[model samples]
Target: MKIDLSEVGRPQSPGARAVNAMTCDVEDYFQVSAFAPYIARDSWPTRECRVEANIERILALFARHDVKATFFTLGWIAERYPQVVRAIVAGGHELASHGYGHLRASDQDRAAFDQDIRSSKALLEDIGGVPVIGYRAPSFSIGRGNLWALEALREAGYRYSSSIYPVAHDHYGMPDAPRFPFYPNGPDGLLEVPITTVRMGGRNLPAGGGGYFRLLPYALSRWMLQRVNQQDGRSGLFYFHPWEIDPGQPRPEGLDAKSRFRHYVNIGRMERRLEQLARDFAWDRMDRVFLPQT
Candidate 1:
């Protein structure tokens, strides 16, 4: 597959560089897919106590690794945990929107998704003091069913998005999409930086980041990221939740077999793997990597 940055709505930077982009979905443990049913969004305020320590651990890890990532915060989270939002900004990380209530893009039409994005962007900007330009759909939910959301994002003043996944997964994946950042021609020409992947036996397996990075062995994850940079000659995007680093979070009740596996498969290894990634690669914020080629 010939990877091009054009469809992602921006030109690639001219020079030899391995880009490592990392982000965190700032939501509490119960907001994840595994526990969404057991815990409703309206009840998120009550669970605020569960996330404070976990976020602290994440901030400390970022400090230790000397890595600066974009925190795609949920509007609900900012409304409840302004202190956490302030600390993340104070720690020198970028703040971006992850939707208002952790709602999936597929669940909403263009209008609803637009409302979510705009609302979330406003909240994050108010709390984080930066121009919110990036978005990652909740659970990578902006798939074929809602590719139209890209246009909404652009119109809402977003410069780029990391919502599409190139690999085939149960929840979200645009398998044949561009593997690198490109100028996706939408309403406002938004940059669609699909999550990183490497082709294997005719399949674009996800290796850039997420559960696969946490569940798999550190060596395989490292190899995949290095391969994305070496073979594609472009920066790779990686993402994880702040809760992923919080090994001590309470396990929600009523999780099915698969949901349990997906959320908690490699909880203990997340911190170690993150440290390894930070040390092995040349990392940069999304803003740094997404600049247009002059």
Candidate 2:
């Protein structure tokens, strides 16, 4: 399972373009980690479900650009909205798992973590009718504290994971982790692809999508990705949530000012920026970009 890092997503021939990984963490606004404190998990079943509509818009956006991306869908959503899972697979996109309940891997012990990954993988594969080999931890939760979770994923039959954010964030990050595709255990172990980051001023700055993609000026975000593509000459992995593009999503009250700002800032501008991003660069699914031989 040892892959030559240099050969990953490299241009096939001279003058060919490097294809970055386009990914979406499929979850609803009510399921966001920050909202977990303010909004009880039990109430999730009753909340207005907008993820189906949002995913429809996302699928349309990808279709317009001819971008075949990855959808790390939640088992909860798939169980409720099987059509969404079928739609993603029908659109020629990769169907991956984002765990069963959006539980942080770090928050779960080894047994619970194993069940989460296994159940989610089985559910997604059953619904999508595609072999699910990829899993992304909720909120990028598989860091140093729970590197064991990566092993759990591998044992659950996942071939790769994009679970570690290599940036210093208040919530979840392994700032010292590699910024590109790497095997956390060994060459034969599961491939852990960290989120894209730009090395600047002696530290890694967030280049991959999330709140940063929405909060930062679109130009600057593009520049960071361009730098990773041009300077480092490596394919970047960018991710966003469906809720990020849905500005009109139900906003829960009693959230802290910081939480509100992070979740809502510039959401209105996201769809436009994403359209421009898809046009500016070549994009593909994580499995195709990193595990091409599979």
Candidate 3:
């Protein structure tokens, strides 16, 4: 599992360009971690489910741009809407795991976390009919306290994970973690790919996608990603959820100001910005871009 970073920034073939990893966290809007306090997990099935239609739109968008991306999907979603998993695979996209029920890795003990990852991986593989080798923790929950989650993923046959975010955030982050992909356990351990960040003013600023991509101006966000590619000479990992492009997703009533804003800010313009992002650079699946030799 020791990734050869020396060849990462280089083009796949002569005259081609280095491609960044484009990923989507496949979960419904109600399943977001911030909403756990407001929306009870029991009510999830009763809530309006818009993920299927939203994913269809996303698939069409990627098709229009000729981009192949990864979908870190939930077992819950796959179970109810198996066709969604089939559609993702049908579109020639990588179908990875987002764990079942959207539980944060930090909140789960080793036994529970192991069950979640293993179950989700098996469910995705059974439905997608493709090997599910990648896993992204809900809300990027693998941090200093729960680094063992990465090992569990490896043991469960996951080759790599993009669950660590190196930036400082109130909800979840291990600010001191390496900004790029590295072996958390050792050279032979699972490859942990942290979300992209750019060094500025002696700190790691969030350059990868999420709510930040929506909150910030698209030009600024694009600049940070470009810096990671051109300045740092590496492939950047960018991610967003299917709900991000759905501006009309149901808004719960009891959410606080911060949670409401973070979830809904600039959502109306997300698809347009994504289209621009697709046009701006080369994008590919996580396995293809990071695990080329696999």
Candidate 4:
């Protein structure tokens, strides 16, 4: 089923000062980086494409709450559906880069990564008619080992990146990374807004939104983000994908139990939870919340 968030008035700024940087990674379900092992690139075309339907649902949800967010878009998606990119910008949201082809920065070498960043930024800017200053790597792939990606992003004219996850995970994360925004490449380095994580019991906990937000109860996710804010005094940078709100989207066959569970868990509950979240806190575009004003 398709839901449309268009025609609704853009949400006004929340009553409180900005509390968190809410972001959405603009990629379809079939484009998830982890699924690359099971789903072939060629096969993506053969699968059902429901990104527009899902994007509408997300946009509608944000419209109801009057939340303006940053959408980290994929170059391929923009190339295919420029209107979707235009729609997002038209709705008072920011357009950022989610990299072309949705490939992780750590997976590609310097040359390939350079090309991907530049091309994606150029495509998004041309289509959205806005400066794409923020980038989030696929799967939070730019960790300590792939620090070079930061330089590439800086060279590409991006001002900040919500790419590093400071939690321990098999696919991607830098457990020792800072939980808040910082200059990773020294003072001249690109601004790094590592996904929000709380240091608990001597370990970095995954508090940034994703599967963790879906798999765990909404109350817990809310509490963690709150703690990151009220106690830690930093904006909790949260992110999710268009697919997270679409439960009826086609599920590819043969994915293992773990992958299946991660992708499919609690989708039905997401929309309602997002509504509560919108009412529960103040949210703004990543750039406004993280980037320094002149």
**Cα lDDT listed for each candidate:** 0.80, 0.90, 0.90, 0.84
Alpha-carbon shift of residue 266 in model 2 (angstroms) = 0.2
Tens digit of per-residue lDDT, candidate 1, span 1-294: 122334533333555666678778888788886577778867766664566677788788778878888888888888988898899889988888899988888889877888899989998888888799999898888766666788788899998888888778887788878787766563347788888888889889888777888778889988888777776666788888878887788777787898888888888888888887888887767877775645
| TM-score-sorted candidate list, best first | 2, 3, 4, 1
Q: For model 4, what is the alpha-carbon lDDT of residue 174?
A: 78
Worst 10 residues of 2 by lDDT: 1-10
lDDT of 2 at 64: 98
Question: TM-scores of the models, in the given order?
Answer: 0.91, 0.95, 0.95, 0.93
lDDT of 3 by residue, 89-137 (tens): 9999999999999999999999999999999999999989999999999
Model 4, 53-120: lDDT tens digits are 88888899899999999999999899988989999999999999999998889889999999999999
- In model 4, the number of clashes is 2
Scored by lDDT, model 1 comes in at 0.80
Off by over 4 Å in 2: 1-15
lDDT of 2 by residue, 165-271 (tens): 88889999988877788776667778888899999998999999999999899999999998888778888899999998888888888999999999999999999
For candidate 3, the per-residue lDDT at 205 reads 98
